[model samples]
Target: MKLNRLELDFFRNYSHVEATFHPRVNLIYGDNAQGKTNLLEAIAYLSSARSHRARYDRELIMLNEPQGYIKGEVDSRERTFILEAKLNRGKTRQLWSNGLRLKTAGELAGILTTVLFCPEDLYLIREGASARRRFLDGAICQLRPRYAQALAEYNRLYEHKTRILRDWQENPSLLDTLDDFNLRMAQFGARIIHYRAHFVRRLGEQAPAIHADFSGGREQLGLRYETVSTVQDPLGSVQDIFESLLKHQESHRRAELDSRQCLSGPHKDDLVVELDGQSAKQFGSQGQTRTAALSLKLAQREIFQQETGEWPVLLLDDVLSELDGKRQSFVLNRIQGGQVFITCCEPEKLDGLERGKSFQIQGGTILSQRSV
Candidate 1:
């Protein structure tokens, strides 16, 4: 899938701007804080209805503006689509698909998916499980609407359970509903684990080979899914996994109450990355970890293509600057046959690239646009 054009108003630093993109490679160049990254953020928001950089939708709006708007024309699944997102302060974000209002962000799945690689992701191997979990959730939510719905409900229930566990001592009545919450959480958690297990399985299959090739046959990469201790088979049917979650919840009920924590569910799931049978986080070198991280993302992109019959858009946000010449060339060489947006401080950095569109950005505006 590819984004054809984008129009923004009061979004981030942009007061108003409209730009058409090249289908192959779109280069956005500007100094730091001049809105190079914001351009990519807007494209991703139009696709997923969520901002990778901002924690709240209101953060996406301009300093004094009460609301922000984003619209993108996309081509995917052999059809064209117009996706829109409205960000209102102190209110829920609204999304639209082809002029029809959408109730959830999941409704925009598979239309304009993107795989973003930023400087922070280079440290994915060394970061905590939450980083890796976010990686998985971000990719899967765009491909599976049901998984997205289940994940949203599971997170909401987890918050309620946390409040109950923390306040049960002062409000004894809250304890009355704790059992009910546990049962419901398990019901949703089952789907979360099932989908995650299958996704990780596919990732395991692809990332390892890619990692090996990236390392030049010198290292082996492995990915394993880890969930609650009581989940024996994460790939089992939803009903069976639900029962397993319930069993684990029962075993942990006393500890959870004692510690005032919500501890039993897929929220704690992790994708274990190993290099040559050792934990990559603890043992791998910087280059090894970086290579492993790149392999994971490239593998994910391949998976998207295999599933959808079209490659997802690849967004590289100042990632080439962070890599060495060898690594930079490796990444650029591999990202073929798909739409790509690369942001950098200098257009000369990618001087030898084939013909594509280039935009010079300044202060949230496109200073100049040209075809190169």
Candidate 2:
């Protein structure tokens, strides 16, 4: 997949801008805070209908602007599509594909898949479980709309169950709805567990080899999906996972009531990273941890290509500057055969890369464009 053209109005620092991109690699160079990352953020929004850095759409709007707009022309699988998004300050965002309004953001997935890598992702190995779970969910949500829907339902159920548990003492009547919420949670949570387990399994199959190569065959990488203890086999049928979750919820009923917290289910799931049979988070060195994180992201790209028959657009947002020379070389070498956008401060960093397109950004505008 490739973004052939992009236009932004009142998005981030850009008041009005438009640029064309090459199909292979596009290098965006500028000084810090000159809108390099903001350009990438716009493309990311077009791909996923959400911003990776901003929590609210209003944050993406330029100062003093009531709304922002993003439009992109995408080329994927011998077809062309126009993706558009309108962000408002105090209202819901609007999304469109080829002039047809989309009712839900989930419908935008798989249209222009993207795998974004930022400096923060280098800490994926050492971060908390929430970060790891987000990595899994982000990738799966792009490929499977059903998984996204199930995840949303499960989160809603989890919140309701937590409220019931927290206030049951004051209003004992709340106990009446606890079982209903638990059953719904288990139903949706089981699907989530199943999808996550399967995705992790596929990721595990691809990441180890890449990690070995990145480590020069000196280390072996491993990934383990950790779910509720009662789940005997995460990759099993939905009925099996549902029954297991329900059983575990029953087992933890008293403890949950005492603690007044929802404590059972896949919401607490984690993906364990092991390097040579050791916990990477706790035992791996800085360089080793970074390599493992890089390997995992590359593996994600490979998995997308394997499942979709096309490489997802790769976004490297000021990440190369954070890596050493060796790691940088390894990353650039492996990210071939796909549409890539790399944001950096130094143009020399891309000296050895194949001639693609290069753009200079200043004050939220594309100052110039040329062949690299």
Candidate 3:
């Protein structure tokens, strides 16, 4: 996947800006807080439904502005497509593709897959389990739309089941409804777990070598899916796990009271990153953590390529300055023939990269594009 042109209006600091991008690499350079990273964020928002940096939609719009708009032309898998996103408070966010309105966001997932590497991503190892879970969900959502749908349904079922549980506590007569909710949620939850397990298994296969290259063979990296429920020989099929989970929901409901539902399920699942025999979150050094995160993202791009028959667009938000020469070179070499959007404060930091296009950012305006 590659973005060919980007247009932003009232997005962050940019009032109106349009730029075309090279297929291989496009670098945006400026001082800190000059909207260099905001350009990348706009692209990410266009690809996905949400902003990569902002916690909410109102923050993404220019101050005192009613809405923010992003439009982009992209090429993926031998087809060219156009995507547009509009963010407005107090109304549902709207999306359009090729000038047609989209009823759902899942329609936009596979059209422009992206792997974003931001400075905050380095905290994946040290942060809570939710961050790691978000990473896996975001990556898989792009490749498999069903995973996204299942996750959404599971969340809804979880909320419904929690409400039913509250009613059951009061009357004890809603047990049947509670059981029905549990069975439905377990069915979908099992499917999500199946996909997550397969995703982590694939990452395990690809991340070790990449991590070794980044860490100079000093550590071995491993990825594992941590689920609360156990799967016996039925691991081959999620249907089997669903049946097993349903069969035990009655007992689980009576014994488990810490939360609204049983704790042993995909909702509580986690992705464990290990270095050698130790947990990376607990034992890895600062550099080790960052390198491991970088390797995981690179592996994600390759996995998306192998599974989808196309490369995902890579977004590097001011990450080049954080890496040493060898590590930067390793990342740059791996991204050949793929579209890349990188943000940096100093153009001199990217001197060794070959055949790249550079754009200067001042405030919210982008200067002329040049080849360096």
Task: List the candidate 2 regions with Cα displacement exceeding 4 Å.
Answer: none
Model 2 gets an lDDT of: 0.93
Which numbered prediction scores highest in TM-score against the true structure? 1
Once fitted onto the true fold, the runs of candidate 3 whose alpha carbons sit more than 4 angstroms away are: 160-177, 233-235, 247-251, 255-264
Tens digits of per-residue lDDT for model 2, 1-372: 899999999999999999999999999998999999999899988876767788789999999999999999999768899999999999999999999998877787788989999999999999999989988988988888888789878888888998999999999999999999999999999999999999999999999999999888999999999999999999999999999999999999999999999999998999999999999999999999999999999999999999889999999999999999999999999998989999999989679987899999998889999987
Better of 1 and 2 by TM-score: 1
**Candidate 1 clashes between residue pairs 3 or more apart in a chain or in different chains:** none
* Model 2 Cα shift for residue 300 (angstroms): 0.4
Ranking by lDDT: 2, 1, 3
The Cα error of candidate 3 at residue 130, in Å, is 0.9
Instruction: Show model 1 residue runs off by greater than 4 Å.
Output: none
Model 1 lDDT, residue 147, Cα: 85
* TM of each candidate vs. truth: 0.99, 0.96, 0.90
